[model samples]
Target: MTRRWPVVLVGPMGAGKTTVARLLADEWGVPARDTDHDVESLEGRSVADIFVDSGEAHFRELERQAVAAALADHEGVLALGGGAVLDESTRALLADHHVVFLRVGLSDAVKRVGLGSSRPLLLGNVRSRIKTLLDERSAIYESVATLVVDTDGRTPGDVAGEIGKALGERA
Candidate 1:
């Protein structure tokens, strides 16, 4: 059987989606695409800058477009921005693909991101913000995921390997 083209990774910020996507793409001999990076390339700025300049609604629209284009065009491991799944259309688009949700706990996420991170959403009280995001998005991530991988204490390589193994089993 032919393997799936894009193995999409979705999770909260600091869940290592981007890192694992690169590792998985390398292991699988394909390229890796990140929606956030796509947006940055198109806008000529960082995600934080986009959020600050145009506000979240504008950034989200750009993100939505980036995701749709990537889903349709790219054949690789794709990592989505943490809140991409919040858009219903994006979630619908993901229904047919292999979606992996990288699950990380509060403490782990805080440690991974650090308090001084430039992520727009985690502006103040980074720990509290992460917890809030996790609490709000966990169920949605699970609902859309074909596979859920706990990343609390795992390295990117290990997570990628597990995802590769799981996808292989599914195939």
Candidate 2:
């Protein structure tokens, strides 16, 4: 039988989805699955390396698979990759779950994620890419979000607590 989770966290690179998902899952006493980590585990390589080797198209396909498997096999807090929503299939899969859009402003995101690092997407023009991603993906995030939480100035604990409270209310 298939099982669904209570909350799925979706947002951009610096949105703290991975950390917050852990906090939420710890509070709920369940597992926290991050699709990027799952993909890394499955592929035996980092996402950046995968992109460098196989390219974004291949990475997206892998991400789709990882997201599908996690949604099917894991019954806990799940955090999707920032671009996971770019795939319509992934968006469709998220429609039935308790999806939380963890939003962060560009300045905060730049502060959190920085203009450097192994992030494949923002490798070139970090600021421009981040802005473009925010412009393009914001609506998709909003459309699929059952709840939206602005992560600006909030600690991960505070965000998790708010999510937990919202989950209680949702229940």
Candidate 3:
């Protein structure tokens, strides 16, 4: 089925996709849906726990399904997991939507994410891992995005306002 969303947020970890989605939802008076949350809800566990128990491959499959379902059913602001674009089908689904790539510099991303074990991808050498993930995923994020918003040194409200303005222009 064909579907469209007011805004779909995509980026690497700590790019503020989730926070900005909620802010945008509030501004637009719509619900905010996150694929990561959906996956966690479905699995009844945290993302980190899913990674530990079922592995990245299993978690990715679940994420892909969650993204597909969210795209089909949700009409509100949607936020994707950092690695959701890794799936070809997910990228295809995003092509027809108003996708915003939340760009963040390496230092900002690391600072926002912190040296937390909660993130499976940044388990060791957090800075290096984030840098590598950002480097690897930047192009893919850009490819699927209809708009790009830099979140570096910006608040979630500011970013949401910018996105709201941009979406308004499109409307």
Candidate 4:
């Protein structure tokens, strides 16, 4: 059965996409799926493990495919890996979809993300790394988003409620 389209969430790491997506899934009366989780399960390894074992290029290829397939097949709330928006094709697919950007600042992301974690990209000088990433990808996220939700200093439920209100308005 074709369920309602997945409410796609995209943002920087630690921006609460996963948490907000779960909450939105409930509000939308549909399921939630994270493309990162899908990739992990498919490879039977953590994303960090994938990077360690296969390398960044390989992991990105896998992430690209997983995001592409999920965008095509998932009929629920879908949270993408932070870097997923880098792919032009994936960004193209997001057009006309209820794509919510969980926007968060570097300070907020630092607080939520913490230092020394599994995030492969934030491996060195967490602050500088995050800043660099934001510089690189922030514009892309804004460009692809249908609705932008600031996740700083907000509960997942609060963001979800805001999105629910937005979705209600859309309907």
Candidate 5:
């Protein structure tokens, strides 16, 4: 069967995936779920805390499970964690879904992430890390995405509108 209700937003950190997903859900009048939020809700801890306490590998496991559960639970707009696409199983689950890959360049990502923040991965030598992560994950994201969106200078509303248009045309 063809799934028609859920729209999955995938992208790098600071790419406004959550914001765009929320707007899309609101515009489409569907519920919205973020995998990061799921991890936090399940662990009773913030993402930063999860990283600091449980380590990245453990946090990634939690994220993967959360993504799967989210996919299984509802038909709505799903905003995935930035790195969720790194897992092959998650990509397969999203194969037939409406996946939008929000693309943000390195400089833009650094600016949006900000210089002073509690981002676990961005805590040390974040610029290089962001570049490295983007390079490694861009291919995976591209492979799984049904559509590509460049959100370099667009507001959430603008990006939402673009996504809606794309969805409409494809649907």
Candidate 6:
């Protein structure tokens, strides 16, 4: 039987969504795309620079467009930007797709990002900022995700295996 082969990965910036998505795509012999990379390519600027100059609304717009394009142009694993779920249009798209939410604790997220990564929302007061962002975004992720995987101390391969198992079951 033919199988529906699209997996959308959504989570916080440092939650290893991209890593896991790539692994899953490789394991499944499908394509992998990251929404942020798509945005940067289309906009001709880094996401950090866009946020620096035009504010988050502009970056979010680019992010939304990137997501729509990725969904339309690719048919495998897609890892969305951290704030992608905040956009209503993206959430609507996710509703019809298999979405996975990688849930990672604040401390682990902070450690993974390591006060680097040029993450705008995560700048200064890392712990509290992340906690607040998580509080705001967790519900949206939960609402859209068909499966939720906690990524604490888990390698990308392990996470991919979990997703593979879940995908097989769903099939």
TM-score of each: 0.97, 0.94, 0.95, 0.93, 0.94, 0.93
Candidate 1, residue 18: Cα displacement in angstroms equals: 0.6
Ranking by lDDT: 1, 3, 2, 5, 4, 6
**Superposed model 2: Cα runs more than 4 Å off:** 1-6, 169-171
lDDT of 5 by residue, 36-155 (tens): 999998999999999999899999999999999888876889999988998889989998688999999999898998867578987778888889889998989899989899988778
lDDT of each: 0.93, 0.90, 0.91, 0.86, 0.87, 0.85
Q: Could you give candidate 6's per-residue lDDT for residues 1-171 as a string of tens digits?
A: 223556899998789999998888887778899999988888788888889989999999989888988877788899999999999888887777889999988888888988655677767777778889888999889999999999989888888898888877433
How far residue 91's Cα lies from its native spot in candidate 2, in Å, is: 1.1
lDDT of 5: 0.87
Q: Candidate 4, after superposition: displacement of residue 138 in Å?
A: 0.8
Candidate 6 off by > 4 Å: 1-3, 169-171
lDDT of 6 at 56: 95
Ten contiguous residues with the weakest lDDT in model 2: 1-10
Q: What is the C-alpha RMSD of each candidate to the true structure, in Å?
A: 1.5, 2.7, 2.5, 2.6, 2.0, 1.9
- Alpha-carbon shift of residue 111 in model 5 (angstroms): 1.4
Per-residue accuracy of model 4 over 1-171 as CA lDDT, tens digit each: 223387799999989999888887876677899999999999999999998889988988898999889888888899999998898888888995788898998999998989876688888799889989988888899999888999889888888898888777322
- Tens-digit lDDT track of model 1 for 1-171: 345767899999989999999998888888999999999999999999999999999999999999999999889899999999999999999997999999999999999999898999999999999999999999999999999999999999999989988888333
Q: What is the lDDT of candidate 4?
A: 0.86
lDDT of 2 by residue, 1-171 (tens): 122474799999899999999998888888898999999999999999999999999999999999998888788899999999989998898888989999999988888998775698888888888889999999999999998999999999999998888777322
- In model 5, pairs of residues that clash are none
How does candidate 6 score on lDDT?
A: 0.85
Candidate 6 displacement at residue 132 in angstroms? 1.1
Clashes of each: 0, 0, 0, 1, 0, 0
Q: Measured by TM-score, how close is model 2 to the native structure?
A: 0.94
Task: Quote the lDDT for 108 in model 3.
Answer: 92
